[model samples]
Target: MSNKKQKMDPRVMRTRQLLRDALVELIDERGYEKITVQDITERATLNRATFYLHYSDKLDLLYQSTKEILNDLLNNLNVTFEDKVEFDFSKDADEPHDTFMHLFEQISLNSKLYKVFLTEKDIPYFFSGLKKIIIDFISNGINFTQPDDKKLTVPRELAVRYFAAAFLEVIVWWLENDMPYSPKFMATQLMRITVKGPYLEHPFGK
Candidate 1:
């Protein structure tokens, strides 16, 4: 596993990128379930044998592609928060934090693939992978031990799940609506919601 983290040969990396791009294009053109290994290799302009060198089958390609996407997200977050003492949302309006902006930018960059995956694909594996990534990110960044006056009433895990689910739904909605809002604006809105606690006052009575 450690060896896998080492830099890969440029030629090999280029080949894998081509294959991944081809898969994304094909998935967007048709659906993932309808695609085959031959279709991927043909679209990638690589031989079946070459495709086999990197992935066992179309499913293997899907798994590897999903893993790469999640890793990209995690890496961006790690780099953005590496030296920070706390999450900062007060940066200049034009200069949004990479940690927050990267998520929206990535989705925008790969909007076609994401739209297909979130709506057309029946794979639960992708959602599970994404949820785990979000949970890990929140778990690492947050101090679970609350201050005496602001104690959390819910379990840490439940809070994480609630936040993650809500965020995911927001992403889906944004994509479905063609992302009318800019990434910076979307990120700022999310930060605002997170920083401001939910309103709990009853409209009818105390």
Candidate 2:
């Protein structure tokens, strides 16, 4: 698939951005369940007709806005973890944001939107798709890193699920706690997990 993202018309982009920002702010103030199309349009200073012109409903608006950011993140990332190394764990946010930084940076930039989506996760595709990205990456990395001669103690599917879910929970925790760390700090931690894992030894003899 072509990685080049199609350019959005500036007017359309601005309208959508207004709607998205309004939705996130309203959601943060109230909650998704209590929000309405009229409420969003009023907050955005756009008419209800404009909202309908752009979206079928409030849910559609939420989906499109979140999807747009997610797609942008995936496109910019283009991360091929093929034989990647971890020599730069101590790197700070001043460095160029490539690879892992792209992921965390996107999250940091859209914290309000994400915090709302993550907490109101029942709306569908809002949170699960985000988790799936992590799952897929961890799966691909494990497959690439494993040696042919050595068998994994845990099933590959189980390993992928555990890591993906744990990583997502970490993200949720970060946002919930007001993101005390920077994007680079979060990215560094993800790299550490990707490389060395938690290293939790078994309480009982294997």
Candidate that would win on TM-score = 2
Off by over 4 Å in 2: 1-5, 83-98, 147-149, 198-206
lDDT string, candidate 1, 115-151, tens digits: 6677765567777777787776555434422423357
For each of the candidates, the C-alpha root-mean-square deviation to the true structure, in angstroms, is 4.0, 4.3
Candidate 2: tens digits of C-alpha lDDT, residues 5-92? 3466678878989999999998888888888998999999999998898899998888888788777666656766552454243443
TM-score for candidate 2: 0.81
Candidate 1: how many backbone clashes?
0
Off by over 4 Å in 1: 1-6, 79-82, 86-98, 144-150, 197-206
